[model samples]
Target: MKKVLIVFVFSIFMILIFTVDFPIKGDSLYGKYVNTNYQNTICCVEAPHEPDTLILFNDGKFESKFYGKGWFEIYNGISPRIQLHYTSFGKAALFNTYFSNKFFEKTKIILNADMNHTYTKID
Candidate 1:
């Protein structure tokens, strides 16, 4: 009986951890993300633009334009890489041209700095 109770408690704890909100920090993008490492960069772009604008990271790799209605398609060429529609909304500036994609979804990303120049993301 004791073991059964302990298992139930542990399961509940795990579920809570998974359901908790984990917000991505906006300031974290101030530096460049090469492959996956953050390096210093001078480029960043904001929103209101359609979801098809290609993002060139300071590292050399390119992030394809986000598709899906209201969703920001952030293609990092990594896991959790699937389309992430903004489950929540926040303030972000938009620049450059916009492209059309049907998978739009509302999403938000905190910027470490302003988007002023072009950046590259190398692998």
Candidate 2:
């Protein structure tokens, strides 16, 4: 009975430590890019009016979106592919890039593009 209690307590402690939020702080945009282990290749053109957000995974996958709604996702593929959706003047374009994350380092934005964006993560 004592051994069981100790094991249960240790398991609970391990869970708490592993599940704790380990937020890395810095300029929310630049810091987030670094925190995701993306190295220095990440760049943003035509800064958004709001903060950019990042969702990172241990498997070398990530998603980032600007507050104005411009976004991209990186997947594990032979070639890095990205889909971008932006709207300007009430017109929206969904652009697809057949590039590999290993080769591309910057996220580019063209002016007069729609800005509202959303991202979803899949396991």
Candidate 3:
């Protein structure tokens, strides 16, 4: 009985460790992502005219040319999500936006703030 219980417990533990959807480390996301064709002109709030580039640090902090600085969080699941809680100095300040990880494979990622925008990871 003791042996069976121990095996069962170990199996459950291993399943949780391996099967659980763990979030990717911040290091994997630590890089500069640029959206060359980003446009916020159709948005209700005024925004910067130039394109947008986001730099995510290993410490969960992110900075952008137009989106100021703030912390970021990544949720892992069937459909992974990256939430950016930033503050922009100009009229286009959004508290947070859940950026869908459309295609996160190696150095390329597609994020959709309002529309789908492909971002390439550049060190």
Candidate 4:
């Protein structure tokens, strides 16, 4: 019984480690990107008011303020893909994040469509 338990625990740990890079569970997107502009690495285009507000929680949840409207999601993730289940619209929005071309420095780009309103990180 003890040997079986050990094997089970090891198996679980292996699964966890293997799935970490599977997009559904990447560890990089578990933090806050507040007051930061995730823009395209190519042109780095951003509008004056782009990315009005975006908040992604660690528990696969998100709340964003865009165009004076609240977009809430009970379950969301930014790995593998940036998917948001908007409760207000009763739908899901799949956004592809672009990265900075800078070698030493980097940035994340959360696109909606047109980058008419994204700016550099204020703080």
Which predicted model would earn the best lDDT?
A: 3
- In model 2, which regions exceed 4 Å deviation? 1-67, 70-75, 98-123
lDDT of 2 by residue, 35-106 (tens): 122223334433333344544444434445542245444432443344455554577745554321111223
Instruction: Between candidates 1 and 2, name the one with more favorable TM-score.
Output: 2
Give per-model TM-scores: 0.26, 0.27, 0.53, 0.37
Candidate 1, residue 60: CA error in Å? 25
Order of candidates by lDDT, top first?
A: 3, 4, 2, 1
Q: What TM-score does model 3 achieve against the real structure?
A: 0.53
The TM-score that candidate 1 achieves is 0.26
Per-residue lDDT tens digits of candidate 4, residues 2-120?
Answer: 99999999999887665443332344444444434344343432221334555555576655564122232322333433444443355444434432222233233335326422322
Better of 3 and 4 by TM-score: 3
Q: Provide the global lDDT of candidate 3 against the true structure.
A: 0.59
Query: In terms of TM-score, which candidate is strongest?
Result: 3
- TM-score for predicted model 2 compared with the true structure: 0.27
Cα displacement (angstroms), candidate 2, residue 52, comes to: 9.8
lDDT of 4: 0.41
